[model samples]
Target chain A: MSTTNSRMSRKRFSEPLLGIGGILLFLLVWEAVPRLGLVSARFLPPASTVLVQLVNYLGQASFWGDVGQTMFSWALGLVISIVAAVVLGLMIGSSRFLGRATHSTIEFLRPIPSVALIPLAVLLFGIKMESSLLLVIYASFWQVLLQVLYGVQDVDPVADNTAKSYGLGRIARVRYVVWPTVLPYLMTGVRLASAVALILAITAELVIGSPGLGKQIGLTQSGGAVPEMYALIVATGVIGVLINVGVRIVERRVLTWHPSVRGEGIA
Target chain B: MSPLKRIAYFIGLPVLLIALWWLLTLGPTNFFVPKPLKLVETFWTVWASDRLWTDFLPSIIRLFIGLAASIVLGVVLGVLIGTYRWLRSFTEPILEFFRAVPPPVLVPLLMLLIGINDQMKIVVIITGAIWPVLLNTVEGVRAVDPVLSDTTLTYRITGLARLRYLVLPGASPQIMAGVRQCLSIGLILMVISEMFGSSSGLGYTIVLFQRGFAIPEMWSGIAVLGLIGIGLSFVFRGVEGRVLGWYHGLREMQRDT
Candidate 1:
């Protein structure tokens, strides 16, 4: 509505005020929904109940363990994916012939939803963290690999020619020329892959019964601990927000030199 | 990159992989690595059964409904927020929080209220897929050139005409990208939701096959999933090519200059 009009300074942060208002409104509704008997309190449980559970969970060592286990899998899976994707993406993407050759294979493999592999993971590793890692790594690998490929391919041929004219060696060319241009894409990939890695980690734990918050959620659900389940779900949402904001900060800080990050007020 | 040569090169790797798989399963094939030939036979056998229809169609249909709902809802809300700066600000935090809640995590919560059913599955899919579409649409709509708006306004182009001629085309490329992402996310949620409680669908069928020790059936289910995955993306690309041809052309022209 303000697209054609110039806005005054007071207008800038007003929306966030509205956002705060909206969240407060939502919490009010969440609190009221059960208390007002809109739904059975036994079924929906009041937001207060869930919040109390969340507070209680914060004190429990096992709750902390679940959080730690989740973070560990997420970190480990992300690291494995980043290493594999970057190394393989760089190697394959550097050689024009190899890149072209792998295009079909990449297209074929990229779309296979990782959840489909849950049963396979289960058959292989059962409910261990490896089961989660298998799906997590496979899902996130494509996100990073594809980004790396785009990053490598995005390297200017003019820059390539200039580097060749200077007789730079293969590894040197990549280190000096390719790395700078691709770093932006690589960072983007990592950001995207990080989100995916988390989602997959949760899904794996929930579906395959791997050890994490997801499994905990499953446990609470079947055990009829509705408030505790909601608490765990909220805990997950909090982690997701933190992961997203954390990644955004990291990307902004790391890529301060990149024009997109440097010039943008908005991500 | 001639068509024939491209096709040849494309088939080459898959063919080679298939051949290698056939070779690897030559003697005493393990339970995990079903012989390629045996898998093919089992795939057909399963496909011929009524179970195939029950599992396959519902998964696709649920995913389709979810993707469609998310796209429509996302585009509407995204455009509204993007165009209205005030709306964008107030809702941004809430949207961000909702998005961060992984869709699958909602399955248990949803199951408690809604029970294990197709509706629950569809809702989960919507939750998972909506983020990309909404975010992308916001970006696309927000990026619409102020100059174009001015031109359309100066020409006395009103409301529907302006939106048709100016806004939609400008925002389409990004919208398409979002839809592509949404499709994949929706598919993932569809399968995950099924794995938990439902009686049928690809996910339920796969988990069922797995637990039942029907490895061949499980393999077929997973194989079908891969095919559906590729098929959906391929179709998305084709639709994108048609819809965004103008955007592509404009970018290419600018590149040439």
Candidate 2:
């Protein structure tokens, strides 16, 4: 058993290292291809150039300012969505009659792409950040709400009965038992929504000409500042990566007891 | 709830909301919030003038073309990656990078390289829509039960026979789910690509109206697009239900436990 365990650990360690090596090889090729002139430098800049441009932008005050605005709107929109979705989701999910009544309506509205509302938003809010916030809320709210509804539904009935037997009232039982059980699902929904919100926020700016990083990227591109545009795009990609990684860490910390998370480590 | 009560509750709320909306707009709100009745009137006017069909057709056509192409390419690539372990190892990071990078960010790069035209719009839509299908297909194929695979091997099934009998059916449900998601996302990207750059399509119509300060006309275009989204979702759900009835049965069985 000891030998088997050690062998398993060794294999796990080496496997991820192999995966990392493969990724490094891909990046190396990407950096090399443009420098070799195999692909046009106009279309595909070298990775080193992109890195340099990224560093230059990092030194700018406006870059951080844009980042702050984008993050602020994103967080505010996400907070509003979570509050609204969780409250409504709990009310609807706890009652069979309410769930049945609202399910069809939710289904109808849920599939409408929030991006399609950019025009209506522009009409309603003008080229303001309010429009972006509204769009993010719309895009993300339904996702969390649905996940919450499902999470509530997945609560074990016996556990509820057991809590009741222990003299817990409905609200207390829900607070102690149902909330903890569903918190993992809630976190998963929030993680998914975080990514969606970032995309939609940037998308809102891109389409409606809202003042954000997306607008900055658009300005750079149209002004033929190719390297800067590429740099800004790379920065946006980094932001996405950072958000994903940050959310994942939070998810891991919050859902430490979850079977899926407990089953694997970053090795 | 009984079916009748459920119907009443569902239908009544939206009606009440609409009535409230109409009431809110009646109190001299001008361009900020157009009256619901006025918006309806605008819808009729737009439909009557035939700008609706002319602008809408290009968007729909482009969307369908992009979706069709992406579905074909994503499935092929997904299957290839799934079937070959080495390929999966090589491609996973690239897939992760592309999936994380929002599609609209690519618009500037694509426009710079390819020029702003129908092809560029189509390419953007395809790139936006393809990843979900591809990733899901890979997962679906990878998740094919090893026991079933071993059974196929025991029967000496190989190559096309193995794929046809074992792999395709195993992945069909996930593939369908991926297609549904891609279609929804593709529609959004389609409209967005047009809104950002194109001179034609429903998106362009909305932009045109908004820029012209024709709030009513813009609302009409948005309403029509919303209906299209609703219609597409319903159609896909129906198709998915029919195609994956067995999967649904299995799901129900699992739920019963």
Best by TM-score: 1
Off by over 4 Å in 1: A1-9, A265-267, B2-4
Which candidate comes out best when scored by lDDT?
Answer: 1
- Which residue window of length 10 is worst by lDDT in model 2 chain B? B89-98
Clashing pairs in 1: A1-B83, A19-B90
Q: Compared to the true structure, candidate 2 yields what TM-score? A: 0.92
List interface RMSDs for the candidates, in order: 1.0, 2.0
- Candidate 1 chain B has its poorest 10 consecutive residues by lDDT at B47-56
lDDT, candidate 1, residue B24?
Answer: 90
List, residue by residue over B141-209, the lDDT tens digit for candidate 2: 998989999999999999999888889889989899789879878988888888766778887888898
**Model 2 misplacement above 4 A:** A1-40, A263-267, B1-3
How much is the lDDT of residue B60 in candidate 1?
87
Candidate 1 similarity to native, TM-score: 0.96
Give per-residue lDDT, candidate 2, residue B60. 89
